[model samples]
Target: MFHSVCQVPTAKVCGDGKPSRRGRSFIYRLKDEDQVPQQVCKLFFLSTLGYHPTNDSLVLSVMGKDISTPLAPPKDQRGRHAPANKLDQKPLHEHIESFHPSVSHYRREHAPWRRYLPSDISMKLMYADYIEKDNKCSYESYRKAVKSLNISFTQLGEEQCESCLLQEQHVKADHQGEAAVNCPQCEKWQIHKDSATGSRLHYQSDAERDLPEDTSTRSVDLQKVIMLSRMPGVKSAVFTRRIVAYHETFVSVGKKTNKKNTISVVWHEGIAGRSAAEITSAYAAALEKERDIKHIVYWVDNCSSQNKNWCLFSSLVSIVNSQTISTEDITLKFFHPGHTFMSADSFHHGVEQEMKSRPGGVVFGCSRIV
Candidate 1:
């Protein structure tokens, strides 16, 4: 039955202008002269082979094959030899891995798993270095390998010292002169940078010190003003005016035990502005909670209108003099204007992350942030 259904009857070409290839080639008929319609023939052929009628081309190909020829086994290429031009990735990967010694690793104090490379060391520079070593790999392959390793570059902080910025500008200006060797601006810039570095080291030393049980170190900073009415995935929300909310974070660290306690005071712009009076009030409230400690050291930024003003000082004096407060000594250490990245900033970062992860990213009121 299968042979009868798939039989291809051939006929010689009879009428031709010349004895070309087409004239000599055998012409095969798809069906017998009295067979069923082409569609029904296809359906019958497919049904016998357990194939759908939609595969008419396949059915035609099979039916058109000469029955005189025997079927040959398919040539399997599995387990064949690898291509000669295929690259050996082991050496290239080792070269890329060698970059580990050149770059510094920094782990986030809050999230230890979140490691980062220095901001200055970019992929382009690393790839350039790799090429200098005569490594044989494309930049794209190197980038994929780095990405697979979960290596990421650290972003620059939001705040930078104004003094450092000015000094940089001055140094650039001094370099254009004929005698750039002994420029006073270069000396001054170096002094400013040294001062900033010293202050940061001193703050770190104080924070890491193991002190008496009666003393505690606290780092305080005002977070960036958060805008409310943030609705994610809403196009119109971008144009609307948002309410501003102020957050003051105080991270109290136990010098001896290395324990941390974070306190956040949140308020909207309608309640009070970020004036010295408001800041002093917040500081007093934070201090009120630490009355049990005999000595408290505060690390703050050098913002005269906020932490460095006489208003905050007078307020602190009043708190210390008040009989209700048990604090015997209060010390306020100010970090350099542009280099105040402290524990409070980390706390604010955590708060920002939490706010972003809220359902629908909808923040209607200031209380929602709390």
Candidate 2:
């Protein structure tokens, strides 16, 4: 017989619609699978605070009038064979019906403040458990845990872009021990990204061109369509400061044709031209060192960034699908309005919001779908 304050409280509803039968004679036993026989028929009387949601725990209670029965452990240590009057607990799989919880129906939180969901937190917990099991509680272990947990490091949450699982790995590898380098504005412990503006593509122009054009066709992957939106608000025209902004685009290419892909592009009105070819050309031109000139098909929304097609298919980006160009190329498409690009394009939202946010009290909200 056991009762403790940490156990689930049993409140009997009286005729007057009030809780009654308050008592203190309670006991508790550790929730041990092997100790079931010794713990049954245990009387646990939880004291005050039992009815509160935050105080609930898994604890079995027995009453004075309840009858008792002998029990025996199961041969497999998974179920009790002698509790014939009541079936003992079944295996966890028995309760789960074909459950593969991760990556399915994921709780996608696009909030700039919160990028993770409950399952992601649980996965990190499990990953921590994994670390403890392997006796590898190193910084690298924690970094991997952040990835498996699918969340940013608690401290680096402010650096939303670098907090990505992949980017964390990169930073860890390329930390280079924070040498003292003269920055334009200021210097800090780590090699500040803004100061360094590290080489995105390493150039090997000195090397001979060994690869052929036909063989240069690399695998292009198409990813999920990404959506970008911001919280609505009003503004005034009495500000003295000028406004500045940055625009960006995210491209998701299919691993190969016949597969689906996604691209999330959020750009300013003037910075990223309102043309499909120009936007992609900007990307290709910027990534020339790492990317080869290739034909690209972009299927985006009927927004101004893309020209509106006045045919059976009205979407400007849809014209790519109806094109007659014959070449081994990559195809990118926008995810549905609300979906976000996957692991590939991490900071698409932040880039979009930074650009479209109110500038110099002039409304720059691209609310019009056209």
- How many clashes (backbone N, Cα, C below 3 Å) per candidate? 1, 22
Instruction: List the lowest-lDDT window of 10 residues for candidate 1.
Output: 101-110
The lDDT values for all models are 0.68, 0.33
- Tens-digit lDDT track of model 2 for 277-315: 644443343233223324544433323343233331233
For model 1, residues 202-235, the per-residue Cα lDDT tens digits are 9879877787777878888888788886787787
Weakest lDDT window of 10 consecutive positions for candidate 2:
199-208
TM-score of 2: 0.23
Model 2 alpha-carbon drift over 4 Å, by segment: 1-239, 244-246, 251-304, 307-330, 337-345, 349-370
Candidate achieving the largest TM-score: 1
Candidate 1 residue 316 Cα shift, in angstroms, is 0.6
